[model samples]
Target chain A: MERPELPLPQLHAFVVLAEELHFGRAATRLGIAQPPLSQQIRRLEGKVGYDLFSREPGRIGLTPAGRELLPAARHALTHLALGLTAAREVGSGRAGRLRIGFAASLALTVLPSLLRTFRERFPAVDLDIQEMTTTPQLAALRERTIDIGLLREPPAHDAELGFETVLMEPFVAVLPASHLLAGQRAVRVEQLADCPFVLLPRAVGPPLYDQITGLCIAAGFTPQVTQHAVEWQTICALVGTGLGVSLAPESIRRIRLKGVAFRRIEPSTVRTRVAVAWRKNDPSPLVPGILAALNQGPPGRP
Target chain B: MERPELPLPQLHAFVVLAEELHFGRAATRLGIAQPPLSQQIRRLEGKVGYDLFSREPGRIGLTPAGRELLPAARHALTHLALGLTAAREVGSGRAGRLRIGFAASLALTVLPSLLRTFRERFPAVDLDIQEMTTTPQLAALRERTIDIGLLREPPAHDAELGFETVLMEPFVAVLPASHLLAGQRAVRVEQLADCPFVLLPRAVGPPLYDQITGLCIAAGFTPQVTQHAVEWQTICALVGTGLGVSLAPESIRRIRLKGVAFRRIEPSTVRTRVAVAWRKNDPSPLVPGILAALNQGPPGRP
Candidate 1:
């Protein structure tokens, strides 16, 4: 309720710390850096607007408010841990349920084949999948609602979540099927210099968005953004409506919309990388299994 | 089991801090300095042989050991405060009770007069008195069992307990009734150089014992300590037996031993001062009342 947010990891930190009362042990239990664990508490105090512990020089104690807050905090954490276990149990469906979120383009390419190979390797494991952009996938991974995430342009700088690229593909030119250059084998990026573009919002995938804009910049012109859509299929449908042209991951070619044309971008150096990601502290067994499946073989339309 | 003992004030500190969870508020509640409060906790942790609180930079928590110790510590503290309350009630008999401890010699002098005036002012206040040495009196004061202490050569530097000098008297040379020095109205300290002395051990009253030795040294001799007694009356009776002569406060003359003679020390510069001591943070009404009454009159045989 106070500004940006109270991060959830800090809640876990509070409960463990309250029980242990020792910093070194609690940090070890939390599997986090000890220094960050302390910083997290200060930030949490800032969010809580009241301190949970009395940090006198030679002693530490719970204030009245802290004592009062203890039961509730314990309740939330215990229930959360329980819910995680229950959800984990139900999700796995005896074998295990792996909830996965992926970028729109990945669904058309890596998704089907990855699922096929994963089903072959672990047939009993249930696959619960959702279409998501890179931004929301990261959030889902952190919240632990999804055990694994398959998304494009994974944030390499984020140290809290682990990521491994599963696929890399160059940009393709997407235009209305009836466009004048639709029959060409490939088109130079500069050829679309005057065309209006349809693009995903930068917030959804900052790195990919920057790469697309950078490609246009390198080609000596900025494509006028005429519209936006979160899904590649929607972007293609909009392009099919003769709305605008756009440059996107090559995986967009697999969407198969009748009126949309995908052509290679000449000198196509701008590319998008799709990566699988998960919370670093995620305890789910399915996470590693899924990662293994993603790397077992080259994915394709089988 | 450890050396120097675990200070009890630290225990009180732990409970209050454990409850408040905030150093500033806990310090205010304890009526103690904030800086020392932290130091007290650290010392308490050392006594515990385990950290009771995790003092991470931005956070503080109780370790499992701390959590386990909480209930017991709370029990000890609650009962102590309650016992103190019950004792206070029984001591005062509805008005208020004041338990006092005094240096052994004061029982023969300042003790009786101070009690009479104090009783006169607060007629309903119950009086419980004990004759104890300075060291034990300090322990009793810290334990909160005794409301006030009347002792000699009080430690002026003790920051925890407040001291007010109530009476000061010069040393008297105590000797056998038939001794050569017994006929003199007064004697210089050097005159007792050859006599064996009866005195209280240094352990019972360090400063007083030091003063006696210091006075003898200043007079170019060290009175040989051939006998020791805790009470001045015993010292007088020992002197009566001709076992030894001793330097004592003038108040020792009031003991009226049959075979002992008391003569004022010539200079009178060497004196023993009796002080009323009480815990600074003591909340009882009788303590201040007794202090006022003690200051109200000049103590004497009356």
Candidate 2:
């Protein structure tokens, strides 16, 4: 006879029977009534095409077939338990991968500490980090191509996305140290109204680009654009050459470029916020652990 | 919060949800109503200490935590399925061990074909073979030390023991080829009643010893036992030296001892029945496959 498929429940029952040997005892262990257990055994026997137990007047004994199934049943149950444990470990963020998309600016600021803390806490978790802008990063999150994104504050999109603001820093003016206003502790936005400014293009980061231009508009004059740079390092280099002044996040002061002076903006409300974004409804087990690691108790908060 | 232990049901549910992000679709896939599915998701979230799904007005999406859990859940389910397959394979005798005890006589008889067939059918099964007498073989079966036995028919034991007769061969008279009666095709048991005999002691094989002694008694004269030997080869060698004549199972003729000739007994009812013995109620999965390999189709029958 063709052997029928062995279901997990039946294998589990068989293992219990092999352990107890008595139907009443096994039934008690399984939390089921004796008759039902007996019926299940009968069904198992029908599938196996043999009697697994011999029914004598006073005692029940395992037939040869039943003895052979004992080890296998135990093995299967053990593996099932192992699988559950694996899932739990992955869910707890003690294991598995965390794919992250990061903006280039974070490398000099929060990135090192964040990565170090995550590594120390979840050593087994593999981090897949990709440098991406806010828009593409959010798009990647929506498409499920990435698990988490670290970027500057972004324009609002679908409410299904979640962004946790982790850092906020005041804008600062970067100028050549030899410039006439370099000695000032702080530069007012209106004082440099006619200054030719080196800045990033809107296509590079639309939200931050608009925030800088809006600050210029707020100062009563549209600054003449002299140079455009894709990154902070390039803008700092141009400013050191006395090309023009550029508004940058306070965290950018760490660069310490030669001949470049960083002075706080008079209206410091022109600041940048960095946030972590993800699909609000993502059911990934690793995300919570990653979020916990990313959390630094509201860094740079006012 | 400490990570709670993940249960199998919850992990299974997580796998389903990871496949279908929408609660309604996941609930349908799980064969439950949406509310209970939501409850299960809530329970999973409680265990994980985070949200797995974003609760938006219309669309469902995986939270970072949920995305992290997806692959782990899938792996766990796949492992569970693999474990079940392993159990089934073992239960069907395609894997595991078969412990067997056998009498020395079968080595030259049915053992070769039996082992070859068993190996061809179940290459992964480990065979544990021990050479033993019928009494000890039966004892091993009772003690659950061995799964199968190939031995001479033994005396009745407890009802829990089972015996299946596989080989039956009439006894034959073995004598020196140069002896007066060696030229004869057949020798009457009554004629050899007064001849000197070389036979194994009763302690070695009581059942066979009693049968041989009873045959002499039936022929009306007791054979004078001239020598004793522990093994069939020793007895055959003694008979070859013309020390005496002996009656042995017909399969023994295959030995072809020098200076010894085997002749059929006039009354062939004096036969040896070699059978496979096992515990009647042994529940071992390997027994059925071994039994099938041993059934050699009614040996020496009309």
Candidate 3:
């Protein structure tokens, strides 16, 4: 609603004049003529219903009201300045929070180094990190609960989302150290088709799970899933127990299980893709710099 | 120094428009026409070097910068309002501090009741009461260290200070309980001319000290001084010891020394004057209200 506003211009002038205590000097400092400066003071006094300054011959001084208004006026201006500075920082990408959701597996991949470089470049931007598999991450991005998503197998064409691949890794077979396939340096996707699979539930990462099952079918078999686990490390540990064989991205090799061996699959064209996903036409300025860091990564990485 | 100012009016318009997200409604709410409101937004966007609002067919929304500026704009306006309200309170007599310097002896007289009344009437006004005798009170008032003074024997005329009589008491003689004058109901000033006087040093309160000495001059004798003390209670104690006789304001009778007796002086025209003193042209709104309270003490007393 419209209401009476503080005479900000007049208060600004008053604070300056109160400091100078001389109308001529105050006018010069304010970049205005003396008459206008005096008029502004009179207007303020009229608005306040009191004489803010005592003008007597060559002597001039603040009235009690003027003294009271001075500090309060200064406080007002200071608060306004603080507000503007904060807004400017936010408007430019120098401040505010950015929440990111990523595939839990990416933490074993590019997530750490990418986040480190993002933080160093934009120390003022708050990063809220969440580990979500592809399915939940896509949902979080669409709902805007999360601003950026780092997940595998981002949808190729979606009306609401855009994606760019930041990492790609070949699928590898995981076998118990006592298994006969553990002696081979590489295995074929067709060879794994006969093994019971320790796979992630289809609901956890639908696209990646389907891609794996689709490859098995393409190799002339429907793979049997003996067990399901959410994390690659959990699947590898299950493999170490000789429960079943599992297929995982190359990055899962870093897990270092004592009783499991990782083997590259022959013809490694079927790759697990980690893409940076964001809502199409997202307004955050913080996203571009972060996306650049994710894409560039530390050089010599696939 | 002159610097770039946030176009406050434009930001104000922007915040309102951002809230409404409709130009016509926002303009009506701001009591401005739609085109001018749109112009203000455009001008603000120009100043901020970014579009504050995105205009699309059948849709309007705050751009990132607009969202950034909205809360900051509100904060700035709120602070300005706070400043104005504070100044308004001070401009009237509703708030601020009043430093009062008073004679320590006044605590036994009108000080407590007078201050209680003042506090009730101006509860928001801070009372900074400092104990000071007349001479120092006068000096403090001139230095503007204290806003008001309650002291005795204020000078008849001072160019820098103004005084109003608040309380008057006839001088009383303090004597040793065994002294011959202790049995008398009343004694004349001339009767004490030969007695050694126990009195406050002249430097402690020049006017009252001189008033006492001047009374002896008017009695046709120059009294010999025996003891000089700073406090009236100390003076009374020395008198109780039969060191010498003393004359003091009647309120000193409240001290109640068992060895001392207080008796009236004849021709009671010789009264100790306790006055309210302040700077002649004080600009504090608190002064006039406080002065009224000091002058109008509880009922009738000499």
Candidate 4:
């Protein structure tokens, strides 16, 4: 037989009454008056075709039927409350997953602080973090393969993208420990104008390459080229072996290479800009929470 | 941080729109005008502090936020529906547990049929069944240790109890297999006047005891007691051992005792009434379902 459909409001009223066991108290708990509570109970009984409570001179108690119905009523109320909580959490982006791609260099910059604060505040969000170079990260962002991206300032041609610059750090020079000027705290670009340069390959994309080459041209002479490496760490390792010198973001100082030494440029004017990029049209709920965490990280270095 | 309480109605609207991906179709499904649905979505976006849908020249799609909120919205709605079902089942006496007490002899009479039907009709009810004597069963019913009881007719003193007769079977004479009367198809109370009788102890309760003694007195002779057994099975076994003959309800003929034979009593006017009883004031929901099953069992013999 098909089960009867109970009115939610009445069942909710009955549940509170069953717990309080007194009309006045139950009504107070329900934020209503005793007479209305009594009417509701009566209506419930009328609908159920039986009495749920037995009334006596000064006592009130559930009939056997009421006792049987109590647990089910409680269960229904509990589930409804839980459902409400879950809906709110998901709607506000406090629960669910976020797929974010970051330039490998970010692991040493704002990524750590950003991730820690985000996790502490929104632990229910499953962060799917991948480390990729800026090029691939930009591609993933536009293709919608990743929800968010942290990359070097993206190229201007992509008008369909939006980005926020979150970090800026000055570039430093990496040299073999035994180089003639390796012990100097600051190196003038003109002093090494004829030295062979170990640079990131042009095929690795142009942002960092342009920054390094622009500084050299401003110093009045371009460095002679020697070899190319795909990564900053590889560039540092090659420089340590006396292959050539290269420029890197200052955050790479944390790598602590045994044979390599870092020096600030005498007139340090070149800095790397790290920006968060996403498809301008993508409207994910989690983006706000993630952006909030990123914005709240420590202020960018001077 | 405080969590936002998203309005359920708005989330529901967003979920349906997300699924349909078309404003007009979703509005039709929700039985409202498309403008109102759009307004609801706007209100929801305002509350969430983010747009849920990304609309373009004639097409719409979930923004990342909308996609994330969809599953949770669906979950909340589903749980709410389930909660309603559970509440209705309990209020209508279809879910929950029923603690039932029955006389041991009921296992051979109406008990099986009553249980089968009750289970079939209300499968969600957890049946906690126990066997107890009429005296204790009455006490249990009064104390609310059990919700319902099956027993021989209770005394008239129990005005606070309600009962329905579910089984009525005439008494029969139980004889030793070799007794002279055993070969006869019928036995008269007068024929057993000079023979020893085995009977249930009066200390157990008055229902069966009064019926047995009342029948003997009406027949013009009191039974000469030879033994007292607490249970019908023990009395039947004693008769099988030829210790003494006894009278039993007709249903006992199904026991198939090896050394005892049953004979119908002449002018068989004495019958045992088996009833299902509960406290008159019991407001439990389970009692009605149980009573319905009990009443629907095969009708009692005249």
Candidate 5:
């Protein structure tokens, strides 16, 4: 299809007029004179071969064609705004590319689905998915090198970014099949009060560590956290050897380990929430797609 | 921050050169002479106040600044392309609106998630989500009025649009809690072979309806379908009355009916797969966000 030639400034004027619905009000909004705004809208209408507004003296409203053009106009404006932002960021070499830093533990669970969905949806978008530790991911997001970070719990520096929970799963206790708890239909939180627990590393984030501690506290006693591992697999392996009982999300059921039995914990106290965190003022069209994919369950898991 | 003067032709040339790597190949790619391409790149470097390329006669490589500028260049080009497309589309009154024609049966499982995600991500994009039969969703997509469609398995016209599976869930049998089948750990497919079936209407699409028939055939008997309903709720209502057995996705667990009991079918034979269908050439950037959200499991379910 041949490209149409329309003055960009005239289109901008039309957008302001559409939003305000009055010539004088639109002129004021654009910080310009009313006569110039009216002239620009008329020129835009002439160039587009259609009347955008119905201006009958005292009454003014968007015509059918005007209403139809609103979304495209808004999209064009947004695209331009994003382009301007990218140019500035790129010129300074600060934040043009979106380096999506995620933890290795999420690769099998939520990360694959999120990446696949994001890639398929935004093929032109430059996404650098780096496997990093929670500390690096948080650090990168803070330094503005990474545009977004997907973490298991809310990041320690929540004040710098907007965080929204994308996935939440109740914790299931993994234990050796020969253990006494295996015979029970459901394991109570209080039953593990005195048992040795395999816990995530304190470096994962204090909030998550605190959450586990709170769960144990609610269970009537502090858990004897015997092992501190950085990844869930280590925790599961520890549980497999009858070393300790560990809590993990239900989605972790995809990982099969011999001698391990996963039982739903009664009065589910340990709920893990995965969230997407990005700088509050960072403007990127890719954020919406990333969030959408996360909301859609992880890809391969049933 | 002050807005920088970005030379459009130079940026365009630089992007083409970056993609092609070789000056001659870049010239060929942009349909111009090599001298012009080099000149444009030099001009672009001057405009941005930086040296973009490291040239050593036979070898061509990007400088750190050039590497940094690549994503922004691509982004700006994409936005420009979209802007031109939008301008053409709006000039013809076919640009901003997205006519989404969906199947009536899909309203229960897939349509809600698709609409919710699309609306949340692209609020400015006008959506005409019309609830129609499978035939109409296909017809609308072919006619170019609808940008996308949501329908059950085996889309009516596969050649017209690309179909991607958005959600898939096993069909469970709904019965009364006091029923003999409910007492068993899992209801076998053979147990429901002789039971009366409540089937979806034929208009929902033949392939999906046949999937149910095929499952029955696999179980060694043809189901005696005693009722036909257009929606899952209606079929579940019939099952609640002990009139017939009905099949529904795991999402149906959310729907509350006083007398209906959901039991997972062992050796599960039937699985419902919902897909999003769109025209192969549609260029809307917002489509990915909508697709991502739909691909994510429904909110709060996973």
Candidate 6:
């Protein structure tokens, strides 16, 4: 057999009446007259084919049938309200989760601080961070699995991701302190045109490697690159052995090595930019906070 | 007048039967027998004093009232389900916003890359970032307005914000190429201890300034500081005037300034760390993404 149907207005009246136990109060809460509230509840009971409440003169209470439905009715109304609120919040940019896919390298230098500051400012938000390559980050973002990305340089497939320049730094030459040019007053890139260099792997992408190569060419000659290492520290270690010279960011000086010497190149050529990237239509509440922290760093102590 | 009540079992039966449309299917869906479903509907009709359905011996259809209540019932159920899901997700650290506060200085070098990587990995998460001073960042984190922070060293009120090291670099001296130290192999801090020094302002905090002072003291004298600037590049410009030497990170080499020389200090003593900070008990979803990014940096990029 099919279930009985009840009108929403009548059911709503029944719920309010059930709570207030009085037509006058329920009507007031519903912004309706007392007579109409009573009529609606009666109509609701009639539609359900059940006696939802017992009335004796001025007193009224729920019948067994009415008692059984109170919880479910309340539950339905609450959920409806919440859903509406959430929809509004999402549209206003005040809520919703931001799925992010990122390269692993950002975790060490800037990601921590950026994340910390972001979290400290927006506590009522959700975040999903995943480790991914630039290719996957872009792919996932396009698929709506992620909303933003942290990447180096511009992607070969730039149409999919919106890139914003955030950080940029020039490359420094790492050599042994005892090298003949180490004592020179600001060495020129041409001075090391013939020196063997340790470089990032070819797999890192030709664009970046080509950038370094191009810089060397602009400095007057091609570099004699000997080894390829993925991490900057490894390249510095090779340079410490006096085997060759390598180019890295000035930040590398922070990672001390016993025999490594860092020098600025004249007519600086290789500048690397790390960027914040996101899909054009991505909407995540955390995006604003993360961006703000990135621009401002963390708060002060005390 | 008193409003009538609604029967619990009848509402439950109504919802299930409405979805299934057949007594046997509805009963099966509700994990109950068809007889009970029938009995509950009859009881509901008795309580409401109306016909909720038009029943023909072997078939049934909802009355007008039934149509109106369907949406409300569905809404309530959805909310109940979502409430439970949200609670579980928040407890598991898989959802919820992370508020963050930060200072302006970090925006340049490290913040952008971190935020970009985080957004890419956690597109469904929310982040809130606030730009503030170091003191306010710490206070906000403590007051629960923020979940994390990013700032420089000597953080005040260790009792409030927990600090973690993210990036560290040593100070290098910036001078004019025409200066006497430009020709030196490696100048000690004491060599220009009495020379006018361009220093960062006290607003940046005493810890940092003291570090510079401490380095000079360790080198056997105090620096004769003259001008004070707010930012690193500004101090570098002052150094370019041949007025004095300034200490800064090797990263400062990125800024192009005519007639400036960068030199390494012997027995280097000044080092600065950029850190990620947060309250001890923050339970925001954005925290994990940020933490993951900070620990790994961007993924796949060499």
Q: Pick the candidate with the highest DockQ.
A: 3
Q: Give each prediction's DockQ, rounded to 2 decimals.
A: 0.01, 0.17, 0.34, 0.26, 0.03, 0.04
User: What lDDT score is found at residue A277 in candidate 3?
Assistant: 90
Residues B1-302, model 6: lDDT tens digits: 22224443466687777766789988897778889989987886565444456564575665433443445545555443453344344434445566766655555556667777777776545678777656566667766677778766746457645687777767777888899888986788778876889987766656667877788888888788888887767777888887788876655666678988888887765677667787554434356567778877742210
Comparing candidate 1 with candidate 6, which one achieves the higher TM-score? 6
Error of 1 at B182 (Å): 0.7
Please tell me what DockQ candidate 4 reaches: 0.26
What lDDT tens digits, residue by residue, belong to model 4 across residues B197-257? 9998886768788888788888888998889988788899999999998887887787778
Model 1 / residue A225 / CA error / Å? 99
Between 1 and 4, whose DockQ is larger?
A: 4
Error of 5 at A50 (Å): 50
Candidate 3 chain A has its poorest 10 consecutive residues by lDDT at A293-302
- Steric clash pairs (candidate 3): none
Best by TM-score: 3
Those runs of model 6 whose alpha carbons end farther than 4 Å from true positions after fitting are: A1-10, A86-91, A101-113, A128-133, A176-181, A237-244, A251-258, A285-302, B1-302
True contacts kept of each: 0.00, 0.13, 0.32, 0.14, 0.05, 0.10
Tell me the lDDT of model 5 at B54. 64
A195-283, model 2: which lDDT tens digit per residue?
A: 88999887868888888888989988888888998888889999999999989887778787899999888888867888888877666
Return the top candidate by lDDT: 3
The TM-score measured for candidate 6 stands at 0.45
CAPRI class assigned to model 5: incorrect
Give the per-residue lDDT digits (tens) of candidate 5, residues A1-302.
Answer: 11224555666777778877888888887788999988998887786566778675675766546665666655545554555454444444443356788766667777777777767765656678887656677788878778778776775456668888766778777888788998887898889887898888777766667777787788788988888887777778778899988766776677788988898897885587777788665545456556766777454441
Q: What's the ranking of the predictions by TM-score, best on top?
A: 3, 4, 2, 6, 1, 5
> Which stretch of 10 consecutive residues in model 5 chain B shows the poorest summed lDDT?
B1-10
All candidates: interface RMSD: 18.8, 7.2, 3.2, 6.2, 8.5, 16.8
Sort every candidate by lDDT, greatest first.
Answer: 3, 4, 2, 1, 5, 6
If chain B of candidate 3 is superposed on the true chain B, what is its TM-score?
0.87
Each candidate: what lDDT?
0.75, 0.76, 0.81, 0.78, 0.70, 0.67
TM-score of chain B of 5: 0.61
